[model samples]
Target chain A: MTFDVEIVRWHAVASWTWNAGDDVCGICRMPFDGCPPDGKYPGDDSPVVWGVCGHAFHLQCIQKWLQSQAQTDQRCPFCRRAWEFKAAAPSS
Target chain B: MIKLFSVKEKQKKDAAAINNPKQSAGELRMQKDMSELNLAKGTTISFPDGKDKLLHFEIFLKPEDGIYKAGTFHFDFQVPTSYPHEPPKIKCKTKVFHPNIDLDGNICLNILREDWKPVLSINSIIYGLQFLFLDPNPEDPLNKEAAEMLANNKAKFESQVQAAIQRGAYIGSNHFPPCR
Candidate 1:
């Protein structure tokens, strides 16, 4: 008696999500794992950006939000503080 | 024992639901906003053009503690295709003797105009509208006559509001509908 099976190639499946505290972008209300309306792809195509205020939004979403504001009063949409991109990686 | 085919099919359906090709960005945003809306205590929303038409709706606000208390006011909300980016166009459908809301239903809420931001939701607008009824600002008013009356004499202003709500009476030359 003997077994008669040979393995060939393997298929793998995976999934991931950004570690941003909030699940969705406040500006576009889209999940961080997905891209905003203007973006064609998720993840790198619609990178999550953090403000100095600690709020996170899709890069494209925040850019549009900031552009909509007056030049002299560019503030974070969530907290009304000055909008400055966080230089460091977002903490868990 | 993973059912990969079924899982992938479900994922496809979900992706399509989230990003419907026919719907615009503004519509998607509005749908999200509406789903999370927490209306003020005395406020209720209704879609006149049916549930499918999320863009145009009405808000029935009945202030519980204010000069406008016991009066049911109707407000019309027109959310543009560029909403969230642009604040919804709100008008007081039921005419009243409000300083912030004029005879032509033009409202004087700051958030509805220059103060609006994409971060603000429909809930925020509802809260702002409710606040106006709670405390009508005579300083920044759409109804100049009402503002003058409110500033000059409190008792007279109160009577004018009563007259408009109870009898649909005229305050000076403008005819107000009985909204009680």
Candidate 2:
């Protein structure tokens, strides 16, 4: 699928303007955007994490997302889909 | 408005987390190994459960040449978190009577099993599967009877393959998933 930069930019700007004090990437719901200066969000090259709904996040961010929701229940913080670590097979 | 709402939610969640740092480190990783993926034409990927669930994805393989021409097979890939380090578990959800695939929908492909390597990508595995349909190997047989027949008698093997594919029962075995 072709990504429309203008559409993404417009959405990002609009989201920023309305939220006023949020640092989330509107599309991913994650706080990091790989842009410099503030750098609250982890830079790219961090281990990528995927939700059961197919959305992805940086490992650090997702771990934090999961930790935040620990009190209520165990579900994906974004989509609430049941999430589990894929079990690794024994190495030969 | 929708975009704004999502950003706000993210911020609220972030704030809530700062106050309570105790939570499960629930993390899942399912990125396809790009270096190993060797997709050919007519193969496509689908999320099915939106973009959030990448571990449970589907791949459509349409063979252009083989006894199973013009046929579409669906394979479900369940990638474990240790992917790239460990091979994803793949199963042929489509049922076809072949020497390499047993009646119970189990596939006897090497890449899916002992031969898997971190260097192999989704595309490479898919191509390997497609190759099985195009050229059913009898030497390493999952369906030993079919393999024996094919190895011993070429004509009988062809007849059995044709009969099974045409939705006809072979040797009292009734019903096969329609592939026409």
Candidate 3:
């Protein structure tokens, strides 16, 4: 007697979600799991970063937004408050 | 082998999507934002293009304090397809004697220009516009004469503001349409 093994593809929906209820990144209006425009997947690039204001965005989106801002008004684009990272590691 | 697997995946996705057509990411976000809009007192929102066209709408601000008190002003908000990333283009449809707002209906607001962020909702923009009526910023004004008048003579500025509220009050030469 012989036995055969059957393989199946399993799918899971992982939301790059924050404490906030929004499923999409507020900056890019793109789904958290999906990559930003002209972006690659499953890498250090364009990962989600959370602000101290409890808002979250794509790392690349916030970086580009912050660069164009003046020093006096260097704040999060979403809440119009001072930009503070929830996780210190994301800043580096 | 890869091509065959990709075709099979596409077919699976198509079958899954057939039951319910997907809305663009922008539409879903807009829906969420619109549903959560918390308009202030004396402020009302209207959509001329029906409920389906969420991108175009008008905000009526009846500033009940300061110089603009009791004056009804209409503002047009046009949200682009690339919203959240891009700020909405806002314009004053009701011409009033305002330093930050011009005769051509262009407004000088930081959020509408360089300072806009994705986190800002329609409620924030409405408040910004209302703040202009309560305290018009002469420091950064779109109307030079209005700014100058507001800076030089407080009495004259008050008079001018009153005159502007009157039906068809002429400021020097140009006529301001009577706002109801």
Better structure of 2 and 3 per lDDT? 3
Q: By summed lDDT, which 10 consecutive residues of candidate 3 chain B come out lowest? A: B20-29
Please provide, for model 3 over B76-156, each residue's C-alpha lDDT reduced to its tens digit, 9 standing for 90 to 100: 999876666678899899887778999989999998888777777787788899888888998978898889888888678
Model 2 ranges off by over 4 Å:
A1-92, B1-38, B159-172
* Per-prediction CA RMSD (Å): 8.1, 16.6, 9.8
Clashes by residue pair, model 1: none
DockQ of 2: 0.02
- Write model 2 residue lDDT over B33-150, tens digit each, in one string: 4323456788778878876566668888878776766667788887765554456777787776678988676889887876554335666677788899888898988888777877
Residue A33, candidate 1: C-alpha displacement in angstroms = 1.5
CAPRI level of candidate 1: medium
Native-interface RMSD of candidate 2: 14.1
Predicted model with the maximum TM-score = 1
- Per-residue lDDT of model 2, residues A1-92, tens digit only: 89866544433333322111234432223344442112244444433445555544445545544564445564554465675543331222
Q: Which ten residues in a row have the lowest lDDT in candidate 1 chain B?
A: B16-25
State in Å the error of residue B89, model 2.
0.8
Q: Sort by DockQ, best first.
A: 1, 3, 2
Query: What digit string (tens of lDDT, one per residue) describes model 3 on residues A1-92?
Result: 88796768878887442333567776666676666553577345657778888777778777767776776777877667798778643332
Q: Write the per-residue lDDT of candidate 1 for residues A1-92, one digit (tens) a residue.
A: 99998999889999878879889998889999998988999978989988899988999988887887788988888888998999965666
The DockQ figures for the candidates are: 0.52, 0.02, 0.29
